[model samples]
Target: MTLLPVDEALERILDGVKALPGEMVPIEEADGRVLAAPLSAMRTQPPFDASAMDGYAVRAADVETPRAVRLRVIGESAAGNRFHGAVGASEAVRIFTGAPVPEGADTILIQENADLLDDGSIEATSTVASGRHIRRAGLDFVEGDVVLEQGRRLGPAGVGLAAAAGHAMLSVTERPLVAIIATGDELVRPGEACGPDQIVASNGFAIGALAKSEGAQILDLGIVGDDSAEITAAVQRAAAAGAHVLVTLGGASVGARDLVRQALLDAGMSLDFWKIAMRPGKPLMFGRLEHRNSRNPDSTSRPDTTGTMRVLGLPGNPVSSLVCAHLFLRPLVARLGQRSHTPDLRAAVLASALRENDDRRDYIRASVASGPEGLIATPFSLQDSSMLTTLAAANALIVREPGAPAAEPGSRCRVLMLA
Candidate 1:
């Protein structure tokens, strides 16, 4: 089969994808969650006209002139407490910030601009304007006003806004659950002893971390040997757990021991596409499986309801798997989380020369630095797919398109920044 282009591959993977069902969660637990629907203000903010400064509430006409005006301190008003009586001529009400403006008061005289006397009275030293230093009713937001739009990720400010809008709970998209399976006879878990030919499994942990960063719940299914039966069982377990996405580490290439594809096919998965035209991730595979629950055996009472589970078969090489995850899995999780799936690419200048590219696109690990011209992307000397240390030390991936010509230092390039 011809290698699929990167853009075509991504389009096919995300076609018709949408966020999962919504769930109601308390505002306290809504942080980092995406809003399933537009959130409207439940009640008006500052329902009543309130003071904005610590001072006395008086009629604007009483303190409009520059000359000092003395008025008797008739009463006081505080937050959540209001003075019932009106501010008569030559009378003022002592009010603090956030306190409701007493009836018949049109302005606030800041205490710094007022002089207190031995008697229960204050003399205003500055002219006051009408409606000054007062937060009007519905100043921030009014009831039924949309404060946050749908598909918005709730952050600190978003949560605070929801709280201020009188929402104790919010409707947010349910986080996607991802089930990860690693396949390889030569693989072993970390912290365990391994033979001379065996190595510790690391792709599952990296993939799980990537998924979790995108607000996805992870179910690591541990390691399975190169046996087809074990692979089929792992797939079944993922379906049983109702995972939205199943990420398989290794066993995707067309090698003798690569049994993931055949096992998935046996498990009733329809292959979408495989073998992309990208370096370090050419053997990437995507497919979908129809999951049916056999626990309910009654034909009439339990209808055969089938749900689709997405499958992503990643290469065995650690760097290749991680790079593929960044390109594909991250966007998939973001789509399920009700967020726009777009890579954060920035323009940068090449800090060193590079040779002509092959048919496959390359994601060169590089160190990105800010310079006088702009961002500078300096790729590492080694570009091997098996080098995990270089990948870890790099802060960005310099993108190089297929069939591109040789480029010199200071040439413009595009880079995908890694968080």
Candidate 2:
């Protein structure tokens, strides 16, 4: 009978979570890892002022006339080769791209825009602007500048930037070792036969896969039943194995056979708040567990690691569990990974009229397609909390607020993208 709004719950959960520890990882294996520490440039980019074109490096004044001016080609310069001699007033250096610009040469006349005269000299055919086509020393970045900040996810562009700034290894947040456990007596593994009330316990597998996608190390603990002792034993064993976070499915609500709440209490977790004002995921629990093997110090001088185990007790319904994971568990993992880049979730309006806005906030399954006016989100006709097929087909959520007015076709509505 208690429910908190979406944004408030997210903020509270984020405030309580701690970032994962940092570790040194090789650059070759660094894509998608969150940077734990800011990286400084080891050496400046472009190290020296280099030519930016395959042309003649000359003083701007020498190329003033396009047709009749004859300039002697003093020496040849290519990439990695520097012209030691300076260009005279009417002389130019043959330079290729990435070659160091010769002394006293302030411009590059592109070869396409100039004709090579008969005696290994060059004839200027266009007026050249000074300082054109030149990559100055440290043009991109200077040494010791902070190139990559902490909490950045290293994608391809980020990786390329890091490499350009002279980093071969990066210090990134250590991937938190998380253990996922699903519990239900009526649950059977996929590829197995099902009795009257048996489900495949497929949500756990899906969640584990999603966690792995976020670069978290997942330990799939398989399934446990409705037995309290078995569940409690599994919880303790997972904690003992140094798991930073333990996510469990089922037994979160006030059900009679529900054992997750009791098991979490036995493991010394101070339950925060449970349940939220959202459909398909109302029975969610967030809390921290005190170490089962730590000694108390009279409420003072506590160690950093003790009482720091994080746990999320999710609902048993597959759709609800996955939705709750998206709301709570994914952010928890991202925080631990020190990933500051929360995927940019943009909002869009519902394309059609919506009749009912229930008393609770709704994340309706929807598909989005491009319209002449941007993305148009269309809600799926069938939305059941137990229907995973509908969830699979959906790529977004029409975020309907509690007690919202009946919406018209072109109203400004918030949509949470899922794709």
Candidate 3:
């Protein structure tokens, strides 16, 4: 059978996916969340003309000239305590930052530009222009103005802006829940005694973390050995938990023990594709499981369920699993969580010569560094799919198109940044 191209496989995975529904969350808990609705200001900022500095509020006409001018200090105006009286001619009001400017004041004389006299008056050392050091009403934002647009990710500044806009709670997209299952008999959980043929399971943790970084909640099903019944049981649990996406590690290839694909089919999943034409990870699988109605629990032998779940089966090789996650799983989670996703691809110069590629598009792990000209990428000599250390040492992947001719050093290439 012919292998599916990587681009086509990804397009199929995201063909009709839509963001999950929205939920109401407190503003304090809204950081890093996507806004579901446009957030408008509840009230105008600086409801009244306010002082922008700790100084004296006076009439601009009273001190228009730069020469010394004396004005009697009438009353004090501090934040939250406004001097309701107006500033008459030759009169000034002591004011602090954020204090409401007196009704008749048109400017502020900064303390540094003024001197306090023993006769309860202030001498203006500099000319006070109209509107100087005064914050007009609605300067920051007006009531009914949208402070944050829909589908915007709330960061530190966004959260603070929402609070200043008088929003105690905000509407944000719900986080997608992903269920992860690690399969294979030669795998054991970390910290446990491993048999001679068994290695510690790790894909679940890495995949789970990757999904989380894209805003998906995780449900780890732990390690399921090479039993068809156990694999089917784990699939049922994921459906029961209403996982938006179910990621399974191992048992995707056509080996004798590759039972994951068949087990999922038995559990009512419609296969989308089986294999991908990509190096390191080729036995990738994708499918969708429709939820069966609970009312007709006995209509089929499967467990009752609600909502559809996208299933992705990855190869067991550590490096393959991680690479495929960056290529596929990251976007799927971002799509569900209402966040924009784009690969961090960059252009770089090859530091050494490389051989020609085959039909499968290759993602060569490489170390990237800044050069005198630009970024220089050097592919590692060893490209084993199971070596996690090599993958860890790599900061980028040199992307080589299929069937490309051998290239010499200094060739321009595209790279996907991992750092």
Candidate 4:
């Protein structure tokens, strides 16, 4: 089969994809979730003209001149408590920060600019312009104003703004459920007894972490052997659980024991692509499975839904699995959640010489550091896809295009940051 370019393969996978349906969640739990609808302010911020500093509320005319003016402190206005009486001529109200400005008061004489007199009155020592220290009603937002637009990810500031806008609950996109299935006869769960030919499964956890970081909910289907029936059953289970995407860790290549691709096809998955022109992840596969309703007429089992679930078959090699996920799975999940996803790509100077590349695109793991000139990306001596240590130690991947010429030290290049 002709190898598909990485860009073409990604385009096929994301074609016609849309975000999942929205659901109502409490504001406390809405962080990191995308807004499904425009968030409007329910009430005006501050609701009224409020004091911005700890000072006395007085008419601007009362202290406009530099000369000291004597005014009686009629009442105190603390937050949540208001001085109902108006600040008439020569009358002042002791107001704290965030307190509502008293009626007929148009300015605030900060405490530093006032002096406590021997009598019950306070003397203004400086002039304050009208509306100098007052936060006008609706200063931040007014009622019916769209504070947060749809498709916005609710970060810390977004959540705070939503709460301040009087939203106890927000409408947010539902997190796509990404079900993972690890396939290999020689695979065992971590911490379990293993034979000489077997290795503990690690790809699922890594992929699951990456998926969660993209706001996807994970359902680990555990380990399945090379048996086609078991793999097909796992696919059915994923569909029954309403998973938005099914990620198969191993057994995707054309080896004799590689059965994941065929099993998914047997279970009604329509193949989109089977191989990608990329190093460390050439055997990657993508497909879509239409959910089927197989429930008995009177059975209590829920019928399979109508939506189609995406399928991603990744190589079993630890590094390959993670790299493919970073390239493919992250964007798919972000698209489904209606969140933004952008690769951290940067230009750098190569610190060492590199051999001419093959037809396949190469992702050379490298360490990046700030140099006197700019970013310097030094490729690790080892480029084997099976070396997890090298992948873990590296902070960036130097991207080399297909059929590119040899690169020498100090040459400019592009990289995708992994740190």
lDDT (Cα, tens digit) per residue for candidate 3, span 1-419: 88899999999999899998788889888998999889999989978889999999999998987545689999999999999899999899999999999988999999998888899898888997899999999999999999899989889999999999999999999888889999999999999999999899988998998888888889899999899999999998888767889999999888899899999999999999998899989989999998643422112443454778999999999999999999999999999988879999999999999999999889999999999999999999999999888898999999998898898899999999987
Query: Higher lDDT: candidate 2 or 3?
Result: 3
RMSD values, in order shown:
3.3, 4.7, 3.8, 2.9
Per residue, candidate 4 scores C-alpha lDDT tens digits across 1-419 of 67899999989989988998888889999988989999999999989999999999999898977545789999999999999889899999999999999999999999999888889798888989999899999999999999999999889999999999999999999888899999999999989999999998999999999999999889899999999999999998888777889999989988999999999999999999998999989999999998854532223554545788899999999998899999999999999999768999999999999999998989999999999999999999988888999999999999999998999999999999997
lDDT of each: 0.91, 0.82, 0.90, 0.92
Tell me the TM-score of each prediction against the true structure: 0.93, 0.86, 0.93, 0.95
Residue 238 displacement in candidate 2 (angstroms): 2.7
lDDT of 2 by residue, 1-419 (tens): 65887778778777766787776767898998989899888889899889989999998988877865788998988987788889888898999999999989999999998788678888888898899999999998899998888888889988988988878889888787777889989999999999998878888887887777777888778889999888988888677655777899988888898889888898688887788888979888888776542322222342335446678888888888888887777777887787643643666767888877777788888888777877788888877888999889988878888899898877767777776
Q: Any idea what lDDT model 3 has?
A: 0.90
Enumerate clash totals for all models, in the order shown: 0, 0, 0, 0
Assess candidate 2 and give its lDDT. Answer: 0.82
Q: Which one is best on TM-score?
A: 4
Q: Record all residue pairs in model 3 with backbone atoms less than 3 Å apart, i.e. clashing.
A: none
**Which stretches of candidate 2 lie above 4 Å from their native place?**
4-8, 188-198, 212-215, 254-257, 292-307, 340-358, 370-376, 405-412
lDDT of 1 at 194: 99
lDDT of 4 at 268: 91
Q: Which candidate, 1 or 2, would have the higher lDDT against the true structure?
A: 1
Q: What are the per-residue Cα lDDT tens digits for candidate 1 across 1-419? A: 67999989988888878799788889999988999999999999989999999999999999977545789999999998888889989899999999999889999999999999888688899988999999999999999999999999989999999999999989999888799999999999999999999999999999999998888888888999999999999999888767789999999888999999999999999999989999879999999998964422212343444578899999999999999999999999999999987798999999999999999999999999999989999999998988899999999999999998999999999999996
lDDT-based ranking, best first? Answer: 4, 1, 3, 2
